[model samples]
Target: MNGHALVVGEALVDIVRRAGSEPVEHVGGSPLNVALGLGRLGRAVQFVTRVGADERGTRIVEHLTAAGVALTPGSTSADRTATAQAELDEKGSARYEFDITWDPVEPPMTADVVLVHTGSIATVLEPGCDVVAELVALQSRTSTVSFDPNIRPALIADPARGRARIERLVTLADVVKASDEDLEWFAPGRDPLDTAREWLSRGPAVVAVTRGGAGAVAVCAAGTVEVPAVQVEVVDTVGAGDAFTAGLLDGLWSFGFVGIERQERLRDIGTAELRAALETAAWTSALTVARAGADLPTLAERVAARKVTR
Candidate 1:
């Protein structure tokens, strides 16, 4: 472990509905998953988010606690916990409808924290998004910053404004991960690699684009590196991207690129390091999609999965 991590975003329950099955509720939210995944991977993680003092909120807390993630004080400040209705298709991909509210208090900064991660709805929604942006900007000066714009089309009221918000955050981030679909929505008809290259120019040392089963590609100042997606019988795509983000952070930490002392070195990362990080991310994502809900893998599970592949 290099240094502690701070993850700020929403914590909600996912109400999953599939054909001929009862709806199942599970603790979920993009940043929440990343925090939990990092914790399960044996990294010290602190999470700050908003959820009502309700049953679903309790579930969310319990889930994070079980994963060994610490919840910041005052995180449960909402009137009602948010919920996302996830409808699973025949192929196990999910389409989501959200009944959510996001108005989070400013997160407290801790001196020991070396990585700050945030994104998804928390980066673009309401009064809270500004707080998130401020925190990332402040932390970027001293800690490695990672972002994943797990863009939900349903939540973005204005496409232009959403793109601007994502772009601004990208500049503050040392590492940025986006799905191919997210890039398509940001710049219609533009190649995702082109957008990744543009983001790299802005400031992010690494700009990664995940292409579902096609794999993922990363653009950096040194060059680009691509990784093939690990084959898995996906239960659902929920949390896969978040898991990848967690693994990417852990890989960077392992390389001594995550602490305040080494944060500046992240900007000069080489092609080999980028590929190794992406491979770790791919494994994390593959393990998550192999199970139901957003159940990310533990360190043991990841090791075992890799062994089987070998």
Candidate 2:
């Protein structure tokens, strides 16, 4: 609630096993990370998510409120708060096992520049998906909708149903973010960019496919461009894509990417702005993964970093 840009999905506490035994709890969820990312970038952000009415939920609320993002009452309750247990690899990548009640709450209609949904597991988990889909549809008409189908293959055992739901979401979103791995989970045979084109045709004005080290691509009706990754020493890829999403949103504002009300304006926004938006996204993401935690650098920090001449 404040002005614009709502980030919707789960807000869970991640218990990362730092070395493989000691678990460290951090407030995270892809959408929640994006909300924090946006908040750091000085965007007026509202996080619409559901968490159990418990100690962890209260902590998440307090944390987000402290960060300056307002929360509308999350639409679900559980005996315990949602949590993810991460099994880490030698390189710092993680495979997660999630527990707790998953619920999604949609806030009443509010004026905003965009509404973003990510964390596919959270969105498709249960009763949450139906409610989240409805909220997405409601905002699709008057606002820009962004989707990051951060798919976890183990969760979506049915490939066909997974692809179908992904397609349905494409129709409801204005922008989509998917890593190559995410594309592979949905449809194995086709190329990721090919799949992205399919999504573009479905509805999204632009589709972003992020390549961990290779960089990212922005495919749109305007045109397609590949933005190189900012080479930085990696700690982990945690919340990097969420930071990228925040970068895209802020880039749009900086590039004078204005209203979606007019057709021409929308097209211009899709074609002309995506590449630069993605550039900013990658830069911001670099700063995030280069650091230890999920908290992305603010706009001022980004600008300052860009200014320092090596």
Please report the candidate that would top lDDT against the real structure: 1
Give the alpha carbon lDDT tens digit for every residue of 83-152 in model 2: 8887667776778888745666567786664545555665666667767778777777777678888886
Candidate 1 Cα lDDT to native: 0.90
Listed per candidate, the RMSD to the true structure in angstroms reads 1.1, 2.4
**Tens-digit lDDT track for model 1 on 1-310?**
4568999998899999999999999899999999999999999999989998889888898889999999888898789999999999998888999998888877667788888999999999988888899989988887888999999988999888888999999998889999999999888999989998998899888899999999999998889999999999988898888998888888888887787677568888899998998999999999999999899999999989899889
Cα-based TM-score, every candidate: 0.97, 0.91
Range of the 10 consecutive residues with the lowest summed lDDT in candidate 1: 255-264
Clashes of 1: 0
Q: Which stretches in model 2 have alpha-carbon errors above 4 Å?
A: 75-77, 112-119, 270-272
Best by TM-score: 1
